[model samples]
Target chain A: MDIIAQLFAGLSLGSVLLLAALGLSLTFGQMGVINMAHGEFMMAGAYTAFVVQGVVGDAGVSLLLALPLGFVVGGLLGLLLEATLIHRMYRRPLDTLLVTWGVALVLQQVARDVFGAPNVDVRAPAWLSGAVEIGGLALPRTRLFILALAAVCVVALALALRATPLGRRIRAVVQNRDLAEASGISSRATDRVTFFIGSGLAGIAGVALTLLGSIGPTLGTNYIVDAFLVVVAGGIGQIKGTVIAATALGLMQAFLEYSTTASVAKVLVFVAIVAFLQLRPQGLVSVRTRSLA
Target chain B: MRPRSTSRHGVTRLATASLAALGVVALSACGARVDSGSAAPTTAESCVDTSGDTVKIGFLNSLSGTMAISEQTVHDSLQLAAEEINADGGVLGKQLDVVSEDGQSEPTVFAEKAGKLITSDCVAAVFGGWTSASRKAMLPVFESQDSLLFYPVQYEGLESSPNIFYTGATTNQQIVPALDYLAEQGVTSLFLVGSDYVFPRTANKIINAYAQAHGIEIVGEEYAPLGHTDFSTIVNKVRSADADAVFNTLNGDSNVAFFKEYNNAGLSADEMPVVSVSIAEEEVGGIGVKNIEGQLTAWNYYQTVDSPENDAFVEAFKAAYGQDRPTSDPMEAAYTSLHLWAAMVEKAGSFAVDDVVAAADGVTYDAPEGHVVVNGENHHIAKTSLVGEIGADGLIHTVWSSEQPIEPDPYLEGYDWAEGLS
Candidate 1:
């Protein structure tokens, strides 16, 4: 029963990680930009939610209003970054890495300056405040909500890519930018929309994060590395692979932590990830693209 | 030949880069001081500018990083104390000049800034250090420089330094008394949960020994790294352990997540109460009263402590900061430390470190918490222990207290069980 509970806890944690990494997968796998400032976009979304909460004055309504508000705010900012900075470095992966890192630092400082250093309390709505308990198993409603949100996000993203016209354009550009450009698909426009949606997903992840813990300037930073790990380990451009990897890592961490110290568990996870990467360099679900060749 | 020569230069550059990186890694591993290039000391005699009509003292707090939220409040209280002192004709007819420096919430940074304050700034005394690590880092610097440090935070007892005066409650004054209260309440088994740090580690060690001596069963022990929020694994462990009570030493933002999880786990105060040493009124607001309304916290002072002195102090603090600003034990201790230092200086009729140290014994102040007296032996002050319940108003109200100030016992020599442990 304890094992089941612990695994359930891990699944919930992984769900949040998946939500956050969905954006990274889209940007890094599809857009071919490192986007080190991905975490900062998440921070921006969390702060937007905080701002909306202040305006609404009621927790439930504010949170409801914040989801879409956060998406738009995060998406528009990502588009702006794509135009001004990221677009120039699409061909230069290393330069994009450095520039995005710089952007992340700048955004972190801006958050600190605006919000102050203290962790802000974003009160969970009354309806989502408690937990649902069975005979021997208990699960927080917030965690369940986040898990559901993650599933919805992943399924919706998969559908958008497989079914929608915008998804087709993004897939075309991602597969062969030169060919997509020649076909009058407007690769730049696709990039903007893709980047916007990617960042918007990160924004929603940030909102889910606030439900679990206190929000701070570096709230997203704590999960950024893990999200990167999920994207990398899941294989580039593979949403299904990312989900599997996130769940596996989360469960591994929780179970490992049951026996060992947290720091040791983290080190073990990193070691395992490194070992796995050595075995499968192209990741779990490698896509054969011209870029890979 | 030109290509070979360029390759050789590249090899040399790579070697140099690797060597520099190795040196940095090695130095950081051993916690060795890297010389931070700052201004050279330009003074022949202590470098203190006592010739001016102002006496300069340093206010060192973590103005940035993880600790900034907590330390900023301490900074504000320290500022308030300084202002109040300066208003009261400024510590021996000279206005107080404060030299503020940010610790950046790092121990090395604390050590570096302490050195800077002592050598370059040449402040007579430096006040501020919330964590044990920060205090430990600054200890050697103060000792080597023959300076004074006024640390104003309740900490794990087992240390006493002549250079530092601890104005806050020691473990004996807070932790042991809380344990005593728990034992009196007939708690047989205790589950210890804490942030992995010096304070919690040491506090748990003492708790372990105390429990052993008192014939109590230890059900479980767990720790999470500082700033870690996911408490599900640990909370699951706590739930399964089924202990009579939990002694939580988790600090900072971690408490918010822990309480939320604990509440979600349906663990009420009546079933398995948590006696926290870290969470206070300031933190209750952040953690939410709904999550931890019935929870117990042990501290020397609370915003709801009733007294004329406390009323005045609270009002003055609220007037300076804001009405909503909750005054916790650490903030009150910081405010009291400045006045205590001033009183010591006045008693000695000098601002010199040795003089102040010599005159610090038996110095009493009608502090906001209550009447506090500085212990000459340990350099720690006497404090009353108050166990408070987290009220709906997000304030901690005292439900239990010692009724009198407990004498400072940095090295728990009074207890036989705490002999080898300390």
Candidate 2:
């Protein structure tokens, strides 16, 4: 029974891990320019949901509004950031890191000034707040909801990549930017679109996090490392690899938590991820895109 | 009990940071040479002098990284205290000059900041620290530097430092009292849950010992990572474990999922009561009072702790921060610590660390919580304990209390089964 329950827990947590890492993998893996401000982008989305909830006073309505709004906000922020700071440092990935770190600081300070360094309440809408009993095992409806939501996101993203013109352009740029430009695909526009999509995905993850708990300035920082670990361990820049890696990580974490101390389990999870990365530095998937290079 | 050691680099960095915080004033203070040999040493003979003009104080918090959210509050409150003190004509005829340093939420960083506070700023006393890990990291720094630190948060006891003054309630005064209340209410079996960290681990150890000595059967024990969510499995275990009560010490937003899952499991306070230490008033609203109402909580301060002192404290906090901003246990402790430090300084009539520490033996303060006295020997405060029920207003109401403030006993000196545990 405990094992079954743990499996469920693993899936729920894994879903989140998957969501958090997908965008990080794209921006960090393909671009090779780290986005330390990635977590703040997620925070912005969570706060957006919280703000909508404040006005609507209805969970379902607030969440429905928040999801799209979070995506838009995230996309806009990404375009602005890429335009202002990141684009200028194409040759200096390390410098981009420092610049993004600065951006994170500014965003955090702004959050503190606006939210006053306190955790804000992010209510789970009434419809989703309850639990469903699965053969006497209690499962939070919200967790199950998020798990399903993640599945939908994965499928949609996969389809978009396979079936859309924008996806082809993105893949082209991801594979070989110069070649894509020779083929009349604007690499710069592709980068902006990719950034927007990645940032928007992060925003959705942020909204999902609010459903799990409180939304604070430090909210994104908490999960950002774990998210990065998943991205690295699975296969950088590969969504399919991210899903597989996150699931493995999640199961490992859940089992460890079940059998040992939670902190020790976390430490163990980190150790395993690092060890896995050591063996497979390119992740489960190799970077084969010429445009991306 | 674990003997947590402070890191070497952590100490040096703390010293450098503290010095940086003190600015030019700290440099000059460190340059002072005075020898009073007096009882209090107001200006002369002190290891560090402040009589010339401004006194440097340090605020150490993790301004970056994971621990920032929690630690920043302590940092902000300390700043608020310093600002309020400066507004009141400074301390002992010298204006306060605070140097701020970020601990980066790492224990090593905490050690570094402590050293900086001692060596660079030459601060008379330093304030701020939230986690047991950080406190343990800085314990040796304060002792070795021969400085004073006011730690403002309740922690797992079985530990104390001579150079530190703990404003937070110790386990005997907080956790134990909750246990006593549960026992009184006929709770025979209990489940232990907490975050996997120093405080929770030590707290569970104490709970296990206490349970054995008291004939209470321990049903199950569980732990999660610091920021872990997904509580379905753990909630299932609790449901099947059939414990009469749950003692939760899980920190951060994990509480939201835990309580939500607990509620989903149909385990209400009426069925299997959850007596929590970590989920305070600030967290109650976040976790949703509907999901956790009527649940038991153990702490030293509640906005509902009745008294003129509490009233003024609440009002003053609202006035200082905002009318809507609610004060929680840690914030109250942080506020109490500043005044207590002031009392010790007033008693010693000096800014010298040794004198204030020496005069700290029996110092007492009319804190917002209540009248708490300092135990000079252990550096922990004597405090009352209250086990409150979560109210619909998103606040906790006191349902059971110690009736009197308990003495500081971080080492569990009264327990026989916990022999040599401390």
lDDT of each: 0.83, 0.77
> Residue by residue across B277-299, what tens digits does model 1's lDDT show?
98877777667678888889999
TM-score of 1: 0.92
After TM-score superposition, what is the CA distance of residue B136 in candidate 1 from its true location, in Å? 1.7
Evaluated on CA atoms against the true complex, candidate 2 attains a DockQ of 0.32
Off by over 4 Å in 2: A28-33, A90-92, A267-281, A285-293, B1-45, B48-127, B264-266, B288-291, B341-363
Cα lDDT tens digits for candidate 2, B1-422: 01102221222233223223433532342233222112122232224657677888777878876667677666666777777777888788677888888987667678777776777677788888887878877876776666788899899887777788899988889988888888888888999988866788888988898889888999999988666666766776788899989999998878887887787556788889898998787777667778788888899888888789888777876787677766778888887888788878889998777789888888888877788889999899888888889998999898987878899888888768777678
lDDT of 2 by residue, A1-293 (tens): 66787888889889988888777766765555468788899999988898899999988889999998998988788889999988887665557667887898788888778975656777777778667877866677888888987898788888887899988887776666677788998888878888888888889999988877657787777777777777766666578788998899888988887777566777798677657756765677665642212
Give the lowest summed-lDDT range of ten residues in model 2 chain B: B1-10
Give per-residue lDDT, candidate 2, residue A46: 88
Tell me the deviation in Å of residue B61 in model 2.
5.7
Q: Pick by DockQ: which candidate is best?
A: 2
Off by over 4 Å in 1: A291-293, B1-45
What are the candidates' C-alpha RMSDs? 5.1, 8.8
The interface RMSD for candidate 1 is 9.4
